[model samples]
Target chain A: MKKLINGVDQIVSEMVEGLVAAHPDKLRAIENTNVIVRADAPVQGKVALISGGGSGHEPAHAGYVGEGLLDAAVSGEVFTSPTPDQVLEAIKAVDSGAGVLLIVKNYSGDVMNFDMAADLAEAEDITVKQVVIRDDVAISNPDDRRGVAGTTLVHMIAGAAAAEGKSLDEVEAIAQGVADNVRSMGVSLAPCTVPASGKPGFTLEENEMEIGTGIHGEQGVERRELMQADAVTEELVQHVLDDMHLNDGSEVALMINGQGATPLMELYIVARKAIQLLKDRGIHVKKTFVGEYMTSLEMTGCSVTILNLDEERKRLLLSGRE
Target chain B: MKKLINGVDQIVSEMVEGLVAAHPDKLRAIENTNVIVRADAPVQGKVALISGGGSGHEPAHAGYVGEGLLDAAVSGEVFTSPTPDQVLEAIKAVDSGAGVLLIVKNYSGDVMNFDMAADLAEAEDITVKQVVIRDDVAISNPDDRRGVAGTTLVHMIAGAAAAEGKSLDEVEAIAQGVADNVRSMGVSLAPCTVPASGKPGFTLEENEMEIGTGIHGEQGVERRELMQADAVTEELVQHVLDDMHLNDGSEVALMINGQGATPLMELYIVARKAIQLLKDRGIHVKKTFVGEYMTSLEMTGCSVTILNLDEERKRLLLSGRE
Candidate 1:
């Protein structure tokens, strides 16, 4: 595999170092851990919002760390979950009087570790509340759904509430509200290579695509022959709309997120079809973002996220804090 | 071969349609033409800036069309220059009484077509000036150098000046000055495939890399065994510093641009090394941008651009218009 890393084992720490160096005015790394926090963390009156998982899905948990986004992000190795101790350090670093909120994606490893971290923080009298995001509509069973790009939306809502100096209970409720409303589905044309493995987790023929794939190169709902851009986008969007019960006249926010290697041109193409699909069904798209907000290494694919927005959610969505 | 385009022949138009639909608040396309203009074009009494080339290098010409960037961008097919008529239409649509400026890359086709368009615009009593950017230090001959990612910096500088109501002559001079001061070099691990061709422009084995490939997937100066990221970056950076004659205490703005498929993690790794290298050489990096600014379709590689900045250029660079 052709990766620009110094050593496979050093990917996580080096990436954290590089991120901190590049955004010194906006972010900083914990002294000896894989934890990234806002440059001005521990704001005396604001609640702290922290989220993280593996290292491969970049800009996901870390890149969103800014004034109106995440206050801190705890990272593990690629495709691995961070230890509870690391998450506990992040909570201690960012917690202020208002309390702290943990935005955990619904991966088995991530949920367990973050829960332990929350418990540890609570033991220290740091009121920590956890909002588990399980918004992947591809999974038929709600209890078995895996969190995906929609987690970034949860971060935005919770971060905005925290930045506005909301209490711990208010922030957790608002975050949970977004988690309940958001749904996402993804399609992958190619699999990503983990640096240590130096091989793709899976492979698709030249004309095949995996519909409803998860971010960490997980299997999708179906492997079918490649379809037109519009058709593929329709399938993804349809799943989300149906799962969210977003019908005619339902107002929502849309995100066309790229899974690393996808081009912005293609993302816009997907966005075009998605907006038209929603418009044809009488769904009003109040806000839209199209880019590589969260990525799966160099995987070539995209995810469509729909967040059923209310006044509070919409206000937080367009807060423009970051 | 695995592109998300509808058809090989329709990639350009479809991509333009998608771009306009996604960014309606900031951009619009001229009807029936491969030309994208600012949603608020024809700002009377302000010089207009226009730039264009192949469609593959997105966000270079179109994504930069906002408050402090290009007023219009003409697009050709993938890896192909737009026709003179398309460029002429862009000039006519964005030209206000203050005149217009065209930022042309050093590619032969782009230069010829844009020059023809300028002549056509002149016949219609529209004042037009051209700035040809040829900052690639990879090409030994100064006259034969091809413009690369550094062209975006010219747009940022010229765009800011024009937005500030600078005269046509003033904007053109500032753009030309930036074009002269900037230098860039790139390395590619694989080649990019043009949709019409259905194949990459060239091929490389698993352990090979091109030292200075052009954005069109053209062969670079050397194709040798793959090296570590820092070593490869050192070669590219050394060429720029030597060619530019930048010495100790020189202040420059650095850009570590990903060529489409490269991950943000890798780009940050490159940025870390590039910044450290410059610091060791006693050059001060004033501002830095690390992301996929200009890309070669889906090629896995990156480019480094350094602009030897003066006070005026620094002011315009930090104007943060876009």
Candidate 2:
């Protein structure tokens, strides 16, 4: 209700307009469509990369569209999956002769829609491949684990590979490699209200916090009394390390992500604990990113993602162009 | 307060520790001192640029320290100014043979303390000059205007000048010129709770908001009901334009800064409006930065900063070296 949008129906459209308008040289929104493609998309002989999902998470799919990232991003209404046609438009807009690769998060809706888009692209004789990122360590069922911040890492690695003129299969393999190695877990201090709903999806007592909350305000594994910053971060970090089988001497690229509404100060505090704990376990941190990469529409909390790094993965991850 | 912090008394120290830990290659903390310096500090023959303020504003002073932005940043406790000795220590640590330039926000504590530090540096035979940025337009008296987000512009420009090997006087003049030309104003949807204070700085009804609120929750010019996003952005943009005396064909760098808790979605909405309105007036936007450049600790709202640019500033502002 307190959101600064004119109407819930216009949130996605207006946001796409604003994003393309803000970065005219870097991005372009397809006419009358909720798809944003790089201004110079469809580079000849280069594998194109496309990704997208719900609208509330700004800078995730769209903000990453540039030279070294996604070639296109399709957006849905807030917290809702984009229609298959929208994804198809993005695919068609960015497909070069080399082919196209889609990075879909593991959410059921996202996976279904992106897969349909790939099918549509294939019908047009466009060579297309897809990888579903299931990186959240919170869910016990691997098939049910929803992608979180770690999906951004997948986009970076896969996008870089595509930008390097790799074959569609090569890009797909790297995307899947990142998907298999990355793990993320989040904690929420409060719930977020979708603009259309104007009501919180869920509620928590003032003294309680949710561990492993979904980006859309889905119930976490547990809601418990708030703990200190280090303790909360320790829980998420341990979950990720355990889930990924990262042991002593493992190297990683750490992402300390704020789930919308969390401040950089708190994110750094969480990062401090994460880094210290990882060091204690003799894990080497190759790179550290601390900021809001993915968000949950003003929900308060943080997520920690660790991408186990190999030479190829590290090269592509660090190869971000912009 | 639902903040992710351990001890309020240790927040500043711990945050700095985390920052340096995460960016060990780029930054380092002065041992036992609340100061962050570039890892390769005291670059011979390069004018050193330093800035600092209260600790709560993460990424302002410290985060800006890098190759082409700042050489050193001193930190005070939360919402408190660093003492003169702390500033003096920063000056000493980063003073190359060329000189040192101090960029101080126009808070009473900061001005007095930095001036004292400048005097201390002179006593120690270190060539030092200072510029106090006054960019907020809400206050009627120019002398009383508080430096808000526009201080970042001063840093970018002056630091670039210093890094470009400009003379001490040249860098000071450029910084002062930026401070004089830039204008900023903010609106807050909710009050922030400082960790040590464990309570909101001020309270607002659910539907209420504050215009021209200071970065540290200082009282703004008006407390009013929230309006549509465009209308709010229009008011801020008009105020800044009026204060800057900008007109048709003016070229400027626009910054849509989110006060920590505001989501990027809202910031982009605000940026959309700001850009459209400026274009309506035939103003040419040379560059646009939309993000949490400077922030109030988890305060929900945003600020708009416009730096009317001349050729020198246009070049220097765009001269950020990573």
Candidate 3:
């Protein structure tokens, strides 16, 4: 494939440089670490929020580390979790006197690494609170929770609370509240390439799409028959609603995230079906987002995430949101 | 392709449903329209900040609509612009006694359609101000100002300001300032397929990449010989920095956005080089976001956007941001 770069080894650093260069107003590189933080991070009393996973989902963990979202983002290699030290550095970079909150997705590596870093920070008296988002309902990881698309909600809910000067406990509780309210399911069509190898990560036939896939293009729940977008939405939403136990008349927040390769036309088509399916089932949607919040590189297909809204949860999610 | 959908026609609606379902507390959907508004939109007499384009680049128009981002999002069909009537509906829905500021990307159709809708809204005496984001450094339409990647910055700067209860004139000034300070350039590798056609929108040789492309897999300025990721970063950044005439000590925000398909590893690699290039050039990066913010569905390459920032722009971009 055609890429714009000097060499593979230097691509990530170069891109980070570009990121730092482009937004000198709000971002800075953590010294000697593969992390980016807001220039005004560690706002004294504000709980510091730090979240990161792989490198490809940009404007994500890092782009989000601004005034109201995240304070710091620890980036791992592509599709990989940051090394513990990287997470530790991020924790150090943004740790305020108040405390720090580590918002991790349900992926094993991300969990273990960030958890270890949190432990280290706590040893340093940082008082880290951790919230793991295992909200994807599409693929049932036996006895394990795999992080998927809904992780963004955890970041926003937690980050917003923290930005508003909530304590670590409050931020953690709000994040947990968001986790309790959210469910996600994903579908993957085309396979993506690893940056170093420039080769497809998985193999698929012309008429195949893997259901319940993660951002890394790993096997999802099943390889069912390829169907139209609407059928796929039905299947995905069925799992999400059932998993979340959402019923008719329940209000929710919806997220239809593209898995990288799917175009807006197709994704919007999927989004429409997702909304119609909820309406048909009498679910009252309070809010909706369709686009690439979380993504797998170049993977075709999309995922749907729904957050059931309760008064408290809604208040927190919407509190200080404006 | 394998997709979790029941039909094509209903995808967008369903996806919106799923999104709303996931964040009921944080967001709200307008009845019977593709438009989405913040749960806390139109706070008293604050200006309603509205912006949108196609449906694929999630979080761009809608995700940014929460508290300090956007007041309403008007979605068009896929890469197409939202209809004027739809824009009108959103304008009316979120008009909170104060005027509304429409942050539109620099696409021709988007500008024309949003302009038409603004005129219609003007008839309603809702104070309306608009800033066209023709920020893409990539030359689209040759003779016309190409609105490419940098439009997202406009949304961000303006959204942050508007969220802080900025007046219509204040929001407009911020939007205009951001629109002036940002410039973007994009490159695509392999084109991802459109969902309906189940075929790639544009094709590149397996080893080639498309440079200076639009977010919708539209043609770009250059399709040079394929190079390593490092080389790619150098060439793209050189073009971007040169285009912006960024002085050696200028501070800016760098966005390394993945087109749909490239893996995270590649984006990170590219990000690394981007960072180094800027530092070497003596450009102080204030903020950096690397990910798929504005994507060209499933296309294999990435784009680089630079938003030059100053103190005032920085303050607005950071203050009261959620």
TM-score of each: 0.98, 0.98, 0.72
**Candidate scoring better on TM-score of 1 and 2:** 2
Off by over 4 Å in 2: none
Q: Residue A139 lDDT in model 1?
A: 92
In model 1 chain B, the worst 10-residue window by lDDT is: B3-12
Q: DockQ scores for all the models shown?
A: 0.68, 0.75, 0.32
| Predicted structure with the largest lDDT when compared to the true one | 1
Q: TM-score (0 to 1) for chain A, all models?
A: 0.98, 0.98, 0.94
lDDT of 1 by residue, B197-309 (tens): 88888999999999989988877899989888888888889988888978899989999999999999888888888888998999988888889888888889999999999
Give candidate 3's root-mean-square deviation (CA, Å): 5.8
* Ordered list by DockQ, greatest first: 2, 1, 3
Report the poorest 10 consecutive residues by lDDT, candidate 1 chain A.
Answer: A313-322
Query: TM-score (chain A) of candidate 2?
Result: 0.98
Best by DockQ: 2
Per-model clash counts, in order, read 0, 0, 124
Candidate 3: segments with Cα more than 4 A from true spot: A1-141, A144-185, A237-258, A262-295, A302-322, B1-63, B90-108, B118-130, B140-143, B160-174, B192-199, B248-251, B262-272, B320-322
Local distance difference test values of all predictions, in order: 0.89, 0.89, 0.75
